[model samples]
Target: MLPARHAAPLQKGLLLALLLSLAACGGGGGGDSSSPADPGTTVPTPTPPSGLTPPSEADAQRFLSQATFGPTQANIDSLRTVGFKPWLASQFQAKGNLYSTGYSDAIHKAGLKDFCKQFSGFPNDYARNNCWREYYSAEPLSREFYRNALYGPDQLRQRAALALSQLFVVSNAEVEGTYGLREYQQMLADKAFGNFRDLLKSVTLSPVMGTYLNLVNNSKADPNENFARELLQLFSIGPCQLNADGTLPGGQCVATYDNNGVRDVAFALTGWTYPAGGVSPWGSSGWKNPTYLRGQMLAVAAEHDQTERKLPGGGTLAASRTPEQALDAVIDALYQHPNLPPFIGKQLIQHLVTSNPSPAYVARVSQAFVSGKAYDFGSGVRGDMQALFAAILLDPEARGDNKNSDPNYGRLREPAQYIAGMLRALNASSDGANFYWWWGNELGQIVFNANSVFNFYPPDYPLPGTDVVGPAFAIENANSTLARLNLATAMLYWGGLQAEDDRPGATGTQINGSNWLALADNPTLLVDSLDKVLVTGGLPANIKTGIVDAVGVWNEKNHGATWREERARSAVYLVLASPEYQVQR
Candidate 1:
């Protein structure tokens, strides 16, 4: 970008400097001077000026591990040297979308050209509609999703989109082949840090959501209450009437909206359908012979209901309202509802930080959502996702390592997250095709393949033997728990490739323990490194002893060629299976 004249001089200066350096080195000037290195690395474990100490590399790793898919050495080093806020700023600056910014190469590499082949041969509507699921949504796109989660720069956006996906609740299980689902998830990532109002509007119009919620092709005369009920009960506001701190009065939960409200809301949301032919601006001819989904659902004016629509605070929408105007009015009402800020804030906090945030924690995040640092919506808008998420992550309660007094502090590492964290931490090799999708199927929770609109689990799902909110516990039954343990064992020990029956010759994805093998001579250092990577220094003393003992036994048994591999593999498998790694505190 330099001007021609300036570029010529700069190039000359660079060449002159390079020649001088070469001559000086050859002349043996013996200059032992290395200019002071820039921080965030030079000082391997510097204390922060902010006075809140991360203290150790493991501590630093723990923070980033919680915030991201997994912590890399570089991330841990940076956080250890610079502390939390500066590292956060750098991460925020490196944001890019998973589905939008770069994915063509990944898709092409999967050998799925023309994934949407315009199939109309299947007898049933479900099969015919979902034939594309294998390539577009299931395999190829799943590869891209893996690529982004493992190596993408937009970690915060990916995490936020993940949280939003659970709330919005569109799944591949229902839609089959998932072209629209991909677009819908991308939209969530794109809008992850924008205004919540805009995010809700985009979700409302997404064809994937419309199809899943039965809102697309909806008419005023025969309205489907699915999307509308969820929009209030699940997506925006909670099921019950809530106070500012997201608490019910007198231990009693009251419904926020009755069936009548759902009916009215469905009436307002009607007459929107997918744009045909992978076209934008909606309602194009391509909708007849869909190539792939592109833009959101567009409204059909003739099918829209213009009857008096109910708004929050007993306000009624204009009787002659257009579809867009009516939808906008409803979104406005949802945004302004007193319950929305706290309701959404509580869930987001649960999603990102703690499963059981104190009312004070909810209140702080709620205030940020209600009165954001700035008004993001065009005019008179109140919610800002950027401010709200930052509040959730950086809140004092979220940041502190409080496990002694607060036993119900952290969330269980959900199946998808548990796999992702381990996969990323170890820098494992994956073709990004079969392993992730297979894992999703093996575990009950797939990334976008949650079976229904209620999501993989509810927020208030209770822990066994207690009334404590244990959301991930809902998925943890006897069989599923065994699956989690066995799957972790398979991935670390054998890389999820079944030896005899499941693809005997094909090794899907393998975890390389050559690096871990190098450190296996010393059990303390080996356990420490693995512990830091997997549990962030919180590996239980008993688990450590057991793994160390197991590795020692493996060394004794496999005194031959596989001892090194056995040592490393045993350590990873045992650590991952430990209760310490299962529930991330």
Candidate 2:
């Protein structure tokens, strides 16, 4: 029999029900868009493109699992029939989804007007109201994200938005109570499939980015270097020159900029501030209303630094004398840097497909980021977003591994990915809003709520078993592993997560196990089907045998009211808890 979820203290930073608001996520934001078609309520098989050879059913399931949130049977069938290219094209055509409700709903929930104003003269009204907007924007946005990833058809855009979120990081932890944090996330989503250069500028101007990085009200009198440093180091061109394959040239990396260069970039970034009065829909919350975050900060010409400056990689900003011009020059220079291509290319591949992508794989993606120009969504004439992403997914290295297994090819799925994949695979239903799961307590990652600019972990985190870098492993420890086990066990048998808060509540999410129980009698068949959704067919044969043997012990006579269901739950719980399903290949 399978052991039950431990009766131990629950993890911290957890809430009973998921806090969902109308907001944005990395893959959900307004940055990039795929198709014009909406993700209709029901998911149906797409019309397979003619004259294209589809991948095998197993291969299709494997690819879809990695590419989307998790593979749906309908989507899996569609991918196999349409082939990779057409399937991708169809995904590109899917439209983005946003909150169905308004920001006012959040304020209404706080009920400040009825209770506080009626009872007492509230001095902390500013702080009070700000909390409402931020609270609603934060978790509710994640619910929307999960809904889309699990059921929405815009899988590619969602994946791209997630990848962009990691790169251009802005956490709800940092920018709460400001202009709907959703806009910042939407900015990244809107640009995920757009030009990288455009994404950088948009992020630089975003209110959420400004708050997170302290760049919104940046001034030349005493410049803030935080955003500038991260912009060059993390977002645009990295500090070191990565070779085409993403390794140091001859194992001796070269620096692109020095201290003076960083300062110059900082000085160049000055002259922007939150909207005037700060209380308007899109500016910094002001002295009048200090708590509310406003819209994207606007550039102030008077505050601009009009001095000579040195550009990164040996250039002068002589031509860029104004704030906007200077900022544009800086962005263009950073985008064109040779390092930007491979630096971002490798990380993008790591994020979407595998952790330790081969140098050849890195090079292939790098080329796409640089030279691929087959398709364009009309954002700009330069660097087609569609082309860049298509290269990463359709490349021989990324897809070829699906045909031939590479022992060292997969990534350990991050906590959020693990939780999300489970929900998506099981086809869990939710209200789309107020859907909540305390992933941070168990997995150390909440939707858009990273603690720092570094994101959940450093991209170059080295795996414990090997010296190879694996970003997702940074959160992988005994405690978290145990937490994952607890979560898997609870999800399988307990219906879903419990509200860690004082009040009793639903997981804001639950899956119908009827389909699961149908195949409970044959452990092999049951396990194989789940493997496609959970592990993408990476479960080793020996591990499969172990799981089959372990789950077979639960039978009708020994199990509960829904004996077949209990057996199925036991099988899924074991597989989900196993080390085999934790990593993604």
Candidate 3:
């Protein structure tokens, strides 16, 4: 028997807001400010390119693909009202106001300050306080490390998200802090829309990068090769061979670099270390101090390797590659390479939009990454975020021809999206850690806890002839599928609809249980709600029908019973479990 999976923690403030918002609409009788427009409610439809009164399904799909997680009735209506180009512009230049609900803000405010403060200790102090406990306990040091790293830190989420994003842009050395603290998360976010080269530099010095890549402890005599190896293989100048069109040549695979090249890069990476000691005449010890470092990576002179090194391709450089020199060489090497664009662009596209980007798609996006032609910045063409977004959304590959037809060319929904959507739909709170714990257990993917630097799964690991991507594919097997179904069932029936008292701290007070039933009683409305919150605004007819039928059956079976809420809940469960909802597009 396998262990039971769990759901993500719900936010109390969000749930309360949902309840109040719903009640203000007179018990779901009418649409409130947050309530999405009805699917059947007709308005003056726009004349799309085809001169059709309403936007084509492809247009709808494209809008959904680019704008939100997935399409929902509300999103579609907004698209219809605002038009695609305008909406695209807004999404590209999103402000804090884009989110109508305050859930994200609430989550951010919950304990971010405390989290940051806990990790703000001096590096030496931190090591002294917890290093012993970490060594003696059976629990892994990573757990304690993160606990200290993030506890009392209001910027935990932002820091984590930025680090995860940086895995895409920067070279390993720079990321490992061969650079300095110049590259923290806030700086990354602020400069996210700027030059790719700067972003790369920032990533290199980010404390997170230093800690994660082990650059903090890298020294002159024994330079750690982890950052050096990944720098070439994963970050830039990836595996061998390229097409004339600058794409990966057909049948060509990522080749391993000669050991000499690795050694040279490693040598270049030497000398950088976190600031140590207290903030005094000298700078604070880099992230390595672990006490006052606040988990940020910094360059430490003592730990840096100053040895001369030979390149794998037969070149020899003088001993002592300064951090700046190493960064310049590595960045230039990667920037000049033909493979960088396709390699990095492919990953970005997969993460942001789709998994199976076509070859043409890869070519176009890669071009933008290199030269920034389609969305390129000025002469010094670096990977600009605005350009990247344009390439992702406006590219011919992204707006596939299917949009004119069925418009189904989208990537699969990641587990994070699935869990978040369910929470929003259920209007539950993580008051007692129910939601977060549940999701961490069942989804096989957790926020801030990636299985490896490679991420939850590779975008194209399972080559046409290979089976290396087994773990990625297996996430959707029968057992996992059943778990998903069970999750949905629990949320709809026994999960969200239960009286507040049935939960850990409820005082048996029947607090607004009818909202759950009201949601179930109207299948169209229920599916529509899900469409808005979970799928964005693009529920297929088949999915809608299945949900309605499931809810109807459950409702009929339990009609006149006190547990009507459970029946309504069953409907939502069925909908979430559907294959249509599972796929991201």
Candidate 4:
């Protein structure tokens, strides 16, 4: 870490540069809008634009910025060679990274005393803390998440699963363990490219989500409305009535449901309990069965409320139906809601592409979600995620030659994306066992540890001093902005984290400045090359000139033996810390 004293001057300089850059570029923000028509309006299919003829390296990087954690030279090469559709096909079929939820469960079964015995050198207090982190807490799981993001082959799936996790929010704050959390995330990854309905069902039945949303042992006498309300508010059809294109009617929001509706859904969804297995290490099972995270939550008929309830799209959930049947109805109602396609589509667009997509863009994706079928790897179903993802990524708004021209077309890089982008652009190497995961807390988006169900930032959060809404900017403040620059300085100038025996797997995260020494001799070439990799649409001429001039100062004759390395590091550090690179277009 860079010292506070050193960081102060650097922070001021970088902040001034960022403000100037932002002034030059424009403010960043977004909004939700679609169609003025009814929910069932069948939008005309958008024409598929022709692929880029021999895609440019910058274009490939931009696409990968949206589709994957970050882009690499190899991935850019592959995309440039085969083009977009074929590359997407390969990614869809590629094997995904597997989480070790089962292993975590095994660790839990063995008890904390036996599990902590592996570590030889540690204080007495260290044993329990270490054991809890490895076996029960979210530490190990977070490592696995970052590990896959850095090195996994199935990049699109990883990105998509991450997007899904935020929408169907669950946090380690409540469900504190590796087993259920990993299982919930794995379910998301597995079903990421599958049907949206199936993914919804899996999330609903997931013990992890159940625990988080208070859906585990819902009582018939008095129902809890936490999951039911969020199901309508955040997960599925948002609290407002939306058109087929996701726009609010009459240029104003309308309530989708009331408190009564929440109670009705909650009562309908009663009578579920944890799966049958695993001893609760904490020794408590008063309201429900002992904690179990392996299988789906089981139904308990005795605890079920058999009262008739109203569904989302104006349908009656019969009182005669079983708890399982009522659940099926609830899932069906949510899946079939017109707001689902655009609501989900727009958010996915925000996550992957620009924050403020045009209503026409949302309409096109919504149409694909409603009517488009996935012939590649799906069963040609209506709610096909494969088809949905294709619509979002391959849309005319997402691709083509007009990305950088529009002043308002981009998102502020969330901490996670910022770190990943910096590392991937520089050809950084790591085993994913480093301080990067812990740095998430510092950067304000810890993986599985969101402050609440609202996530690290609200999806529609407005950019301060701007009318537009940039979700990631919700975490962008003076402190975080400085922290970002300091991190860049530490990684580039001072050495990044070194591999040590204390860390799991003894693996470090690093980028080699020496590798860029060849290009560093020529400042213009070095700056241009780094810009192509790190900045979408390349850097502004002024910014590029400034960096090139700065890099040129470190000459072989005057700056001595470390001149080349310093030049390279300086070039990287300047670009990464620039406002030009912070807002991804």
Candidate 5:
């Protein structure tokens, strides 16, 4: 049930319209697993940095839907003008906004000092938890993420970083110190387009990741296997062996590494402590440093595991080898492992393009991951993210009408994507201070605060009563599905949140209803415009008609001077509430 305040905004008729739409498309009711495109059919390939244009506006919207936080009319126009390959090139060159260091560090420090001083006492300790939430926790970082995602020039970079964040899997829920968390995310954003090996090493040595996985104070005497186990099972390779195309070999779940191998890797990873600058709240330092998160985990030679160890995939660390040497060997073996390509590539595809990508699609992306360059990129570097993304986005399966035709080609829009997409499509603006955390909390995905290391939902999550996978749908339920409708009604019918006065530069979140209001008098035009902006192909005729008829009920004579506003709100509310808009094809 909605709080009394929100109840009034969602009128009964609108609720009925949404519920009817939900009955048709919600509940993760995915269609069969038929391929979106014929196995032999080839999409018109975009020549990178040159000849490529979206065949239609729907196609352009579809591409942006996959690659960005959400599509905007301006962005659509820009993409149409520059073409696909060129737009991707520009995004690759676009400067990234960093979260962890420099400016953000100053903000985090100030917020901590300011908020932590407000309350004094046990349990009512505002100094501890309050300060963390107000400034130093995932709250502040999540706000910045929305700002970048909503308006930053580097859309693809941010999106890639989000995907990488899930795979690398560090969260403020387990690891604290806002500075460290910000820096951790910054590293992911910075390297989102860089080599996979560099990213893997960075994740391995990161203080935030170190803290989350218990690697920070690790020593040969008490090495932690948490990081080692996840590095293989979650980050680098899966538990089962894959055939280069992401399919399990012989339809068998072969183990990638054993418990013994995990222990060996843990021993190899020992001898790391918090970075040097951290001072414990009690003023401790060195090996016992409090959780300082600003820099890479420091190496302590004396605590190193000097015994020989065999890496899981291949390679050996001889006795007397330095900690750095052993660490290098472990990373090298993992980076060169055959499992890295398809395991990482297929997941990337699921995140960016389709949920169940064809084996051929996975193989194509895997090949790109291995080569680390694309013909379009012309950069001869290995593990190139730019090349990999180009391969995924430009693939025929990601574009064309087949994406809509196939019953199983798309993914349910996760809460973040759904909210951001709606706001972006309706020309929304935000200081990004609160809606993300508030609404995201209500919807079960609060960014940097995922429920666990496994993430909000696993990549292989199967839709209910179906063989199809829709990872985002894992969080959807009776309550969340209704909450989605409630959120839409609030944004479209009522005004969105107002800016927080205490937050510097906060605009709160709001959409330009005027854009929709302008066409409200003509119900068909309003619905069509929304259909173009919000739905990926176009709204199904029945759904589109339902929204139009709902809007038409609010003619001026019957509904007074505010009729247009009512009609406009009804149209947007109904579209967002529909299952068609929930899935990103």
Candidate 6:
């Protein structure tokens, strides 16, 4: 029931060609040095800054802020030699074998090919292959912990908690055969460096994303607004007028909306569809198997709705338009909007680097976006990844060091971040049945199974009377809150420890055998590890003290060896679950 804006056929062809050219040319490469280096070889370390033997706390924090999930000891060591800026530049241009080889191979083996094969054909005989469906189809080990909370043995709880946490952040490589998978992996492997615009286009046409956002079946006649709405509201320019500092004018609270603007933009996004010659259904007569054609989400003229549409505020476009005109208009408007740079740049900083970047910091990042000095992947000037990392680490506001009672500028780690961090930390593989088991439950972020398209939780859930943008204030009702608390407790006791090692004939033998406190006995090590992996270098002393005290209780009671491990594990779960972890600056 939304208004529609169909582009002229001529315009569609022109835009499609332009996009193809840009994609082929790698867009405008941003201004970073284009000298290629061997991705397979490690760069030699630089001398420490003026007699420094190891990285300082500041150095560690900077490293953690930009890397996906958390840093490994190896990763930290590498950063020490390259220094932050150059290391960041290298990440932007990184190539093959960058991820752990074992992990990468296992991901490849996880029926990803089958999934890709199934998704290649759409809107015809092609079977639907929902990633979420695949994930939940298997009964992950974390579920047992949930069951234990309700009826099973209390002793089995901590194992489940760790499994859940692991599941929360791990990225699945199930897109192997799908056309979009390669592109997405390229973006990720590019060290989280790429053009935001290119990333947006890639996500728009990706089968996983198309399925996630319900854009697959969108047609001219019955134009689905789901993708269009989110593209503007969550993924791009965002929903309001804003100052350059990322703060809204008039000091308005979070969750404000430009309802009319959303509607107008959605109208312009009409008429997008897959290529002509509809895909063949499996076993159907005259049906042909569909192959993935790169850049093939074409606008079918016959399928397009050419009705003249009224804009939300009051304007009209001519009827029977082409796809190019419609899409270009929307993208251009969004790109030029004043709100875009600050709004999106801040979110990227929040997701990739820090929680609470200062207004000035946001301004600097946004300026890069606007001026085309940063995030311009076409020129290869350090793609979105390099610009974003620079903004997060180098910006003065981001490095503000007032620790005593400073307002926390971090975001609550989404389930994905938490899970991925754990898997990376454990060097776990997704091919095993234990995939996503340890972290998913602990953090409550199950991949491919967000509760709604609004996502696991609203990005701007408001707090009581504050209208402040923080953690899950919007969705944390009584049931959810209780669930969260119970989830936290369960994670500590059951999710942290792994189940009896699954070696054949292992006979229920406990691994790390009931000594939950073992990791916690050395509070310094535990804290340091958590700081290294979870908080980067930015954990508050008070928070560290709380974890230490909790560890003490576990140690004193001679808690089961398993319980001891759970307590130590709980320290991390607790930190990740805290309010401070959820709100990115």
Query: Model 1 over residues 545-577: C-alpha lDDT tens digits?
Result: 867887777565557766666677667766776
- Per lDDT, the best of the predicted structures is 4
| Candidate 3 lDDT over residue span 255-359, tens digit each | 637666877787677666554432322322443453223333456555655566654323455555556666666666666566666666766666555555555
Ranking by lDDT: 4, 5, 1, 2, 3, 6
Candidate 3 lDDT at 223 equals 75
Best by TM-score: 4
lDDT of 4 by residue, 443-544 (tens): 888777788998888878876666767888777777777778877876776567567554445567777555466787799988887776777655778878
TM-score sort, best first: 4, 5, 2, 1, 3, 6
lDDT for residue 116 in candidate 4, whole number 0-100: 63
Deviation in Å, model 4, residue 160 alpha carbon: 0.7
Whole-model Cα lDDT of every candidate shown, in order? 0.65, 0.64, 0.46, 0.75, 0.74, 0.43
Models 1 onward score TM values of 0.79, 0.82, 0.65, 0.92, 0.89, 0.59
Error of 5 at 80 (Å): 1.6
- lDDT at 145, model 5: 86
How far is 411's C-alpha from truth in model 4 (Å)? Answer: 0.9
- Stretches of candidate 6 exceeding 4 Å from the true structure: 1-55, 96-192, 206-222, 252-268, 275-295, 305-321, 354-356, 374-385, 400-405, 422-442, 464-467, 472-585
Instruction: TM-score for candidate 3, please give it.
Output: 0.65
Instruction: Report how far residue 504 has shifted in candidate 4, in Å.
Output: 4.2
